[model samples]
Target: MVVSVKRDLYGNGRLVKASDLSLGPRQCMPSSQSTATSVIFQQGLQDCGNTLQMTSDWLIYSTNLTYSPTPSRNSPIIRTNSAVILIRCYYLRHGNVSSNAIKPTWIPFSSTISVEERLSFSLKLMNDDWSAPQTSTVFTLGDIFHIEASVDTTNHVPMKIFVDSCVATLSPDATSSPRYEIITQNGCLLDGKQEDSSSAFRSPRPTPDRLQFTVDAFRFVGSDNSMIYITCNLRAVAENQVPDPMNKACSFSKSTNLWTAMEGTSGICSCCDSMTCATAGQSRRFGSLYPGHSRIGKREADPVKHWLLLQEHKVTTLGPLLVISTEQSQARTVTPLSSLVQLWVVVAFVSLSLVILTIFGIVGKRPFKLHCRKAGLK
Candidate 1:
């Protein structure tokens, strides 16, 4: 059988037909045997190519590479708190039977693959007053709230954000009907895209063209204390090119407002694909290979299709869970304790002095009169 030998040496390798070699090994070889070798090389090229493909897959697998989004290409590598590298060393030694043989039959290959790190996007409940991302906070009734999704342009690839579905539960129980109307959604768009002409934005608008975008800036007037669960779904793609509308993997109706449940028709937003569905989980996961610089050109196809490719596509959910409590207005009057005590003491002293003076006049005046009369008679 013929087999084709292929090697990529980064533009340094070459191929030579054995027939063209004038080496002593070729000279000693018989013509029929050399012809048979050539035939084998010619006939088994397809099978050899298949074998190489399988070998490459295995090599990538051994490196522990993952497809989740992660820091790549000169960006500062910020690993998850749970992230750790596994080091394994193998040792081998052998004595060569012949000097003509290659010194080593195999070489070790090492690669860094980030594992178990999830959720490339971050969800923050924006403080309207401070305009900063907040993990947990308290909100009162009639408070305008904004939920922001910040994508790390340095570490992660940018994608589209949609206010998938939001429900405010009056109680912690899952069976409660989530009121979607209490919190009204207004502004949501892709970064660099045109803003809503209605000028309905209540929260501070995000800086344009940045990796970050507001998933939904909403105002929730709480009629009662409840938990607000907002699910913001992201459709992250590697290539900037948008696929044909018909071929989109995920979609939703344009008329159906994302704040509400997915309806077949009559919603405000549309053109959603099948991949666009509401998902709920405590936290999401993101995975990517480290030292991505080494494998740049090797990724020709989109990362969505190949697990080893730069992890080109990621669909993650940034669900910002918030609690809204009813604002109670209790009137409290604060009095100065020092001034009040002084006033009470002064009033008591004046009353006591008046009582003593009245008693002295009533008793001592009569006694003095009687004594004076007795002295006169004597």
Candidate 2:
């Protein structure tokens, strides 16, 4: 006996089936069908056409029959399942090329992966013919290149480009006095592990008269984690004029010895004051001439006569005469003794005369006597 069963597509379990067990001795014989009829019957059971024409509801069968209702080859699911989608990328390219032919080039996925995964990237695309960057380029995730700019502190109109550090040169508009110096807070010129003690920047020296100095700063990007700080000290020397009281000019005549003795004839002597005398000269021969002594002979003999009298007399008055007549000069002058000596001599002479007259009066005799000879009387 033969048996047949019916089951669901998944076939997790079997289902019962029914079939006839008894049969008559003779049954009508079946007729053989042509190949076209068989082919037509098969075609009617299973439909075949382009996937583009298929609708979502249409049942599909896989070649292996492992899956049913397979997605269409033209759908997004097929593109995702297979590696058919192409992604475009971009990046910077460096090389000499004609300006007109310049165009953006695509970057490979492998190269962009470093920037995308690490979340950090840098482009030194600007003209950098100078030194290296002061700080490290390493950055934590989410960090961004904030800004890039330049200022013409030097005030050069054409604008020269400097690399690595921000060049904070002395501006031409800056004040001429009180010279300015440039300083930096971040890294300085580096030579191996050592940093240069000198400033990384440049500015003019301090002015001559100004006591204080003006300082300027220029900062560059430093280590990714650190902030910049700058400070400077200014060394300056100022010029000043000190008054020389000793060399100050005196208002009195410098030529007269008596005047010099009396602190110059003006009677306004600096000797007693804070100032000191610097120069002196002798008075003219006729400086002390009497009304009738203006004669040329007297004038010519004045110096000799004055000298002889000063030597012979030893009197205070003669000292003034001698000092006034002679042409004696000095680079620096002090008070002369002639005036004091003369005053003492005058007092001595007056006292001596009074004593003589007193003596004569006490004796009751004349101070002077006149005698006449016998022959002159006859």
Candidate 3:
């Protein structure tokens, strides 16, 4: 069904324009690799932007990118009116080509920034077992938030990753002036600094390329909104290299009154307290990766590769994470006022029934006596 949408579908000399076309909230982009004579494409629109008019409960998915319907690659292609959308997004309920054959599942969502297939980073809220991605973002207080940040290195060199910094904010804008810093100063868990905090890096690291951690579930008490977004900076380095202050994972131990390293020497954790962790012998190959770009939405693909640069970084935000408070987690339908109103209604109904019965009994007795007197034999 999507054969026409393939990168090589169009014939030679067919008109096509340069595009940075992307899909989904994570902004999955099409490959734009090219040479003077030819181009290579790695990904394509999943459904050729085909419109899926769904019923019987489905989520409407739509995207607005200009599209032109043309004949298949086998035939001479002629362009029609370019549709305003590049790819119309929609939840696939049931389809022959869908990946979810055993069970009805929505299409897979990918949110990663690829720097020329060298590295791509993604942040996800995981389930307790950390086996699969959690579908529901809603979380209750006192629950441990299992978070993971990973990189897809493809067939590239072996690499190690660090959760240099992380923060939780009430809004999606991670850099928004007001933010809560959960981890900072390279790979230090700030919450671990507190004796009562359960926040720390997962021990016996899950994998060399992944950084897993936990945060105590919480909410912004003063804010009315229940949503919270977690943003983190992930840095990658060579696997064989020794961990440094800039590339280490460190958590403070309250019982021992000392800092412990998850993979390396705790000395690297010393700088965490002063927020002075620094990366040594590094240059600005791709310049600085700030908290703004390459975020969850504005991900960019840089095909250009650097020769000596062994380090790359990305910032990702996973969010709208609903943190349910104690009061909010209880059933929402039952409230004090509603309960009181129901009680009053029942009382009023019973009172009206008693009055009706009493009136009927008085009239009935009088009728019975008058009938007896008429009979005169009573």
Better of 2 and 3 by lDDT: 3
Please write out the lDDT profile of model 3 over residues 217-314, one tens digit for every residue: 88786854356778888888877768767678888888887789898778777777676676331222223543343432332433123323457888
lDDT of 2 by residue, 257-318 (tens): 21121112333233322222222111222345534555536445564355223211100000
- The better candidate by TM-score, 2 or 3, is 3
lDDT of 1 by residue, 1-378 (tens): 222222211234433234332211112211333442231122222221111111101211001101122444698773322111111122232322245553453332111211212224444455655455553444444444554543434322333332323334432232356444211221123211224311122222243111232233333453433334443333333334232221122221234434222211213223222222221010111123223533324653333334223222232322223333432311112246556899999999999999999999899889888998989953
Number of residue pairs clashing in candidate 3, backbone atoms closer than 3 angstroms, sequence gap of 3 or more or interchain: 6
Q: TM-scores, in order shown?
A: 0.30, 0.11, 0.52
lDDT of 2: 0.23
Model 1 residue runs over 4 Å out of place are 1-119, 129-131, 153-176, 179-223, 239-327, 330-378
Q: Score candidate 2 by TM-score against the native.
A: 0.11
Question: In order, what is each prediction's RMSD in angstroms?
Answer: 27.9, 57.4, 17.8
What is the Å distance of residue 354 in model 3 from its true position?
24
Give the deviation of candidate 3 from the true structure as CA RMSD. Answer: 17.8
Top TM-score model: 3
